[model samples]
Target: MNRRIGILISGRGSNMMALVERADGYDVALVASDKPDAPGLAWAKSRGIATFALSPKGIGKAGYEAQIDAALREAGVEIIALAGYMRLLSDDFVARWRGRIVNIHPSLLPRYKGLDTHARAIAAGDAVAGCSVHVVTEELDGGAVLGQAEVPIEPGDTPEILAARVLAAEHALYPRVLKEFVANERPNPA
Candidate 1:
């Protein structure tokens, strides 16, 4: 049987859509979001995938994550994929999932760890900007990189332009890496 993967998103979830579209050897068990109105939720619902959404504004992180954890477990999610999930995950939450959580960051990684990666790369006069698919560790984006896709930075390229290209790379890279990761990480196979 295919592994059950859960995706967390905070916005349009372009990466999540890519994973859904190109899914192989795994099933999207759930699509949960911190932003209740995130467009991705609607898309998942339309596809008949289970979805859960709750804003952390009022309940605080602990309570919010508790609910999300329950929802994920209920849906039998074996893998957690963070796609455009804006909020920083608490250490406790990360501990619960550990190596089971993976993320797609819009940078080659070990170079740009946080946001504004495209602009940072351009500002640094880098020749290429790309995306990375890696394990989600307690330290931000400081996980073992499973894969990367490089997009050459053309002259006069703005962050917006570079971001679009990098995003396309992410769409292509994430699903393939996730498939391999699931195949390799089966310590507790059912």
Candidate 2:
């Protein structure tokens, strides 16, 4: 069966666009955001993908996640992809989806779990930087890694340059891992 995917985004959604472009044998059922004016929404809509925006600014985290759950269910989304999504999901929400959710974090992961990873790595004098595609768990980026790709941390590289390289890896890794997941037919992680 073709997987039905719902993508959540906050900003430009470069990774989201990569998925959309390569979504063969998969249905992009929905594109959702917490920002009403996310550029990704416009891009998805132009391609005729269903879109939604649920702001948590006033609704609180649990309430917002509930709305997202409802929206995903309504759209029959079988896979949830966090592509530049900024919010940390609630534990309950993570439990509900389990291994059905995936995120591409711009770090080696289990190393730089939170933000500013590039700057931190550069400052720490790391020779390599990378990104990870992992199953989303309640424990931040602590989930099982599905795949990763590394990029050399050239001397004097800025965070922006490092981020670009990581993003390139993400665009390649996410679609490949998603395809592998469907092909292997592995049971969703609990």
Candidate 3:
């Protein structure tokens, strides 16, 4: 059986779109966001996928994630994919869903753990910059990497330019990685 996947996003969810375009071994059972006006929810709805959106402000992080947890459970989601979900999940959330949640980071892991990854790469004069797919752990961006795709950083390339390139890499890399991940995780059913 295909994995029942739940995708979480906060913005346009371009990566989520990429995953949807190639959802073969997985079912996108739910598309959810913390921002009620998030564009991705509309896009998901257009694709006939279930969606949930709610405001997190003043709800507290744990409370907000509890709501998300409820949605995921209701949808029978077997896997959680973070496309552009900006909020940090509580430690309890990560632990409950350990090894079942994954995220795509704009930069290679163990470096640029936080935001401004593109600018950080360029400012450091790094010759190569890329993206990584990793297990989501309680420690921010501290998960073990599952896959990576690299692109050379051209001289004087602005963060915007680099970001665009990295995003393209993300679009291509995430779906393939997720497919393989799900397959590897399938049970023997012995």
Q: Considering every candidate listed, which one attains the maximal lDDT?
A: 1
TM-score of each: 0.98, 0.95, 0.96
1 or 3, which is superior by lDDT? 1
Q: To one decimal, what is the Cα RMSD in angstroms of model 1 from the true structure?
A: 1.2
How far is each candidate from the true structure, as Cα RMSD in Å? 1.2, 1.9, 2.2
Poorest lDDT segment (10 consecutive residues) of candidate 3: 181-190
Off by over 4 Å in 1: 187-190
lDDT for position 81 in model 3:
96
- Writing each residue's lDDT as its tens digit, candidate 2 over 36-58 gives 89999999999999999989988
Model 2 residue runs over 4 Å out of place are 185-190
For residues 21-63, what per-residue lDDT tens digits would candidate 3 score against the true structure?
9887998999999999999899999999999998888988878
The candidates, ranked best first by TM-score, are 1, 3, 2
Task: Order the candidates by lDDT, highest first.
Answer: 1, 3, 2
lDDT of each: 0.93, 0.88, 0.92
Residue by residue across 102-131, what tens digits does model 1's lDDT show? 999999988899989999999999999999
**Candidate 3 C-alpha error for residue 26, in Å:** 0.6
| Candidate 3 global TM-score | 0.96
